[model samples]
Each structure stands twice: as C-alpha cells, then as structure tokens.
Target chain A: MSHSSPASSEISFVQHHDDGTFKKTVRKVTIILSVVTIIELLCGLAIFKLGHGSHMAVLMIKGLVTILSLAKAFYITSYFMHLGDEIRNFIMTIIVPLLLFVWFIAAFLIDGSSWRELKNTAAGSKPATEQVEKAVAPGDKK
Target chain B: MSSAAIPAGTKWWSGGKSPFNLSYGKMMMWYFLMSDAFTFGAFLIAYGTTRFSANYWPDPNHVFDSAPFIHGGAPLVFVSIMTFILIVSSVTMVLAVHEGHNMNRKGVEKYMLWTILGGLAFLGCQAWEWTHLLTGDNPVLVNGEIVEMATTVKVNPWGEVVPGMMHNGHQVTTPGPVAFGGFFFGITGFHGFHVLSGVVINIIMYIKTRLGHFDQRGHYEMIEKAGLYWHFVDLVWVFVFLCFYLI
Candidate 1:
C-alpha cells in the first residue's frame, strides 16, 4: 500500500492539481467562519452595551446568537468535515440521526422543566415550613 | 437472473471497497462523532432546562466579565477570543487535510503544527478562566453588604439562592447556584478534555508527517481522519459557546 501506484490515484475524491482552488476554498471558509464568530461576539456585546431593556429584547438577542452559532456549525460540518463532498446517503446517515438528537434535547428539556415545577411547589408548601421550624427549634435550644 | 444481480466473480455481500462510497474508518469515525454530538446535546439541554426553571440565575454579563490583560469587567471578551482561536485552528486543520489530499507532506506538517498551537493556546485561556472563577473576588450585594463568594458545585457566588427545590424526596438547600456551577463546570470541562485530546492527536500527526510517514504511505487518509476529529471538536464548541457563554 505504501508503494506509489497509478491505482492509488483513483482513491482520493479530489484529484491533485497545480491549480490553487483548494487553497482558495480553505481561505474562503476561514473568512466566513471568522466573520460569523465576530458577528456573534458583537451581538453578545451589543446586548450588554445596549442594555437588555425588556425580557423580549434579551430573548431576541439570544435567538440571534443561537442562529449565528447554528450557521457556524453548518459551515464547519459541511466544509471542514468534507460532508459537502460525501455521497448523499452518507450525509444523511450522519444528519438524519442528528435531527433526532435535537428532538431528544427538546423532549428532555420539557420533562426537566415539569420536574422543576413539581419540586418547586413541593418545597414551597411542605418542605419550606418544616425546614424553617427545624432550624428555629435548634436555635431555641442553643 | 437480472443483469444487475450477482456478477459471477464478485460476491453480493463481499466487502471489498466502501459500499457507502466512504472508507470504513471514516464511516466509523462519523458514527462515533454523531454519538458524541448527542452527548453534548444532552448536557446542554439539561443546562438549559435547569436554568430556565430557576427564578434567579447568574447574569452571564456579570459572571463572565474578565479579559486576559484588561482588569475590571469585559463581558465575554476572553471567551470570544477562545472561540476565534478554535475556529482558526479548524481552518488550519481543513487546510492540512487538503494538503494531505494533495500529498504535500510539508504542507500537512506546517498546518498541523499551527493547529496544535491553537489548541494549546485555547487550553491555556481556559485554565486562566477557571482560575479566575475559583479565586477572583465575586462580591454579591446582600443586605447592603458585599459578601465575597467563590464558585463551587455546592455553592455559587454568582447569584441569589437558587430557588429551593426537592429532588428524589431530598430537599435541596441551595438550588440555582449549585445546578448552575455543576452544569457550567461539567459541560465545559468535558469540552476542554476533547480539546486536549485533539491537541495530542494533532501532535502525533505532525510528528508522523515530519517523518515522511504519510508520504511513504502514498496517501494521507490518516491526516484526514484526524482532521475529522478536529472539526468535530470545533463543531461541539459552537454549541457549547451558545449554551454556556452567550445564553
């Protein structure tokens, strides 16, 4: 396999060429990713500098940041990982399950929030009084 | 039999080349990375749920307000620099992979070295941030007196008492701070470990390229595989940035 053979030429997806297209592509990707990141940073700063204002405003800023982040993720995955050049089926094999992963997160978060609410109400009603009384009893003895 | 069916010399299920038109190793790497993405996703979602459920959460602006040389408060400046470093390193890794495809051993060596340095620099920045979190003065204004506090899994000085809650029938004395610190440290620490491993792998690849190993092999698929891992690490960081730093 180490020996140089004409057959090995067929293995690579991109034929080695003297043309600098590969270099140019890499440079373009770097610029795009960097610009997106800088935009995200600026958005974060702008939120703080401009002040959060209303809850809705803060949420909108966060939504913008998430959108920027997802854009960066797409570029890195497709270009850097070479998924863009892979076969359509191969891309789906990776991407389709990842969509499921996102769904898993959304489902679990909803469940977690419900649990949090249950815990909060439980603490608010019974545990809060019991713990405070327990504390007061100890203080009286001391 | 149909003309497309069973060519005599080639067994129908024989594993010769990639059926999926990808190398076996690369396919397996993709599978591993996809699973890893789910792990990070779960962590981030847990962080989000816990944070939103809480009444009072740490203000990211106040909590992450520290830069490298500048004193006082500069929200997210340092983390932004770290993000830039990782993105730049991903670019270098992709360039190295491109050079690998071209069988340019020297190009691969140079870019791999740069990527390794970027990883190290990011790790160093994380170390500084962690130290700052542990030791820096975080004074919370309580009853008009500034009470100094540090971040711990059990307690956090970043915000008010996490609304008291119950978990599995046990009462939580401190809710919000504990969960916040736990998730912050846990998720970021896991990501930092990935960065460390990526650096180590890049160092090995760099040494091999310098030794003409890939040149002798007549192909640079090894470097491409390593590039896949590096790119995946960078991808994970994008989400981590959104979950931890920005949001």
Candidate 2:
C-alpha cells in the first residue's frame, strides 16, 4: 500500500522513475501539442484568406490541417494517456485496431460520391414529391 | 513474496500474472477508449459521407464566423479558444495522474480542481455557441420570400450565397444541406456529453481523493484510469475541431 514496499513478485518490472524528468517530459509534450494546434489554426485562417473559388489550393490546405490534427491526436493519446510508456504488446493491441479507420473513411466517402453521381444523372425518376404520402396497410393496398 | 514457489521456467505469458505488465483496470480502460474512438470515427465519417452527397454544402468559415460579443466576428476565433481549453484540461489531468503516482494527495487535488474548472469553462463556451446559433436570425430566400431562419437540427440557413439580398448586415442565403445542421449538433452534442461525463467522473475522483480513498487503496491507479478517459475526451475534441470548425 505504500511506496516504501518492495517491488512485488507479482509484477515483473521494478519501475525506476525520476520526478524531475517525468515533469520535464510532460512540459515538452504540452508545448508540442500547443504549437501544433496553433499551426492548424493558422491553416484554417489561410483557407479563409484564399476564399472559396480556388478549389485546389483550399483542398491542399485542408489536407495539411487534417494531418496536423492527427499529430495532435497522437500527442494526446501517447503522452497524456501514457500509452507510449506502456509495454510493446499492449501498445500494439490499441494501435492495430485503429488502422481499421483507413478503410472505413475511404469506403464511405467513395460510395457517397458514387451515389451522388447516380442521383444527378437519372432523368427518368419521378419528380420529387412536395407532400408525404400515407403508408398503405400491407394487404389493404390494391 | 512467492517468487520461489513458482517453477523456474514459468513465463509471464504462462499466466500467473499480467503479461501486459499492467493492471487489468488500465487495460480495460484502454479497450474502452478504443471502442469510443470508433464511435466518434463513425460519426465523423457519416458526416463526411453526408457532405459528399450534397452539391451545395455550407462553408465552415461562413457558418462559424461569429463569436460572443463580437458582431460580425472572424472565423475560427472562438472555436480555437474552445480547443485550447480542452487541451489545457488534458494537461492538468495528466499532471494529476503524475501526482497520484508520486503519492502526493495535495498535488493531485489541486490539479483535479484545475481540470474540473477547465471542463466547465469549455462547456460554458459550447452552451453560448449553441444558443447563439439557435436563436440568432439569419435571413434566407425561401419560396420567393426573405424568411428569417436560425441554424437548427432540421434546418441550415448558411446555404449557397444568394446574389443580392442583405438584412441587418446578415447575408441572405438559399437553404443549405439540412444534414449539415444535423451533423453539427449531433456530433458536438455527443462530444459535449462525453465532456460532461468526464467532468462528473473527475469530480467523483476528486471527492474520493479528498476522503483519502486513493491513499487507502495505495496505488492511485484509479486516478490513472480516469486520466485516460479525460485525455480521450481531449483527443476526440481534436478531431471534432477539425471536422466542425476548421475544415
């Protein structure tokens, strides 16, 4: 129950920690996260300055900000969550599942774009209804 | 204490103790956070898909332009403040966890108080933003009439910019993609809920710390687990800020 107790045989490692260095790393990570967030904010402002018409330039900047945001996420999860100092196999268990997002984002965006294309090109569809129609009972409708 | 009782060849993975070199509680917390990440990921991805489905989506710059007490405010100013607030809270939380490790109950209490204050500040900002958006009138040309509208779950007024109509210095716009308002409120409201719960958890942790609960337990690992949840909140905000405010 106390720090004075010897390293228990139940746990494998004898943790050797220095108070000063731990605080130092905390400070370093905090500053890094702040700077990265500032850069992201600047990118947002740049997008505003570039205006709406320059599609390519605006897209590029948005991509940059997205990457920077990912970096910020990494810092928070790794340092603030202390996952970086955790054992290797434990870290893998967390990181490996997150990789699922790559395919998840891609598939949704792709299909969404495709559906838009289909909707716009189909001219034979009935005009959009202005009022909702009541649903028919299963066997009552002719 | 029983190191000699075990067979000499017994490996960590052979199951006498945690192979992860961590407590079950911390490992379970990690798994919980991973699942939470997927939840937010699905929300954001759904938002993106909805965005792609629409031809005339609202630009975030125009939509988030106003700040409190600043008429005709600049873009990204207020939201940046919100982001920084969450970030600062996260830092305080990590410090609290560190104090817990060192068995400094006073230090932990101090940092926990600061973290709670930060969470409440962030919530207050969110409340104002939501209120302003919900009640502030912006004129829109609907059915050949300039009808006033506010951003709501069912409607968005920051549509494609209309050519030449203005009322009280607010631009008239065609109705935007309805899902824009839906996603904005739904996702942010969800994130705010997480922040709310995190604050509550931190409060409980603080009260227990005040009562010497962690001291009795001896490890302060409870504080570490709560710290993980708090940082996860901050981590989600990073992406939420990107999805709603910046891009």
Runs with alpha carbons beyond 4 Å of true place in candidate 2:
A1-10, A14-16, A123-142, B1-10
Candidate 2 structure quality by residue, lDDT tens digits, A1-142: 1342212335565342467877888899889998998999899999889988799999999999999988888788777787777767778899999999999999999988876776676441434633578898899977
Give the number of colliding residue pairs in candidate 2: 0
lDDT of 2 at B99: 83
Over the stretch B79-152, how does candidate 2's per-residue lDDT look in tens digits?
A: 98999899899989988987887789999999999999999999999999999899978899899899889999
Please give the fraction of native interface contacts (Cα pairs under 8 Å between A and B) kept by each candidate: 0.47, 0.56
lDDT for residue A35 in candidate 2, whole number 0-100:
95
Range of the 10 consecutive residues with the lowest summed lDDT in candidate 1 chain A: A1-10
Poorest lDDT segment (10 consecutive residues) of candidate 2 chain A: A1-10
Pairs in clash, predicted candidate 2? none
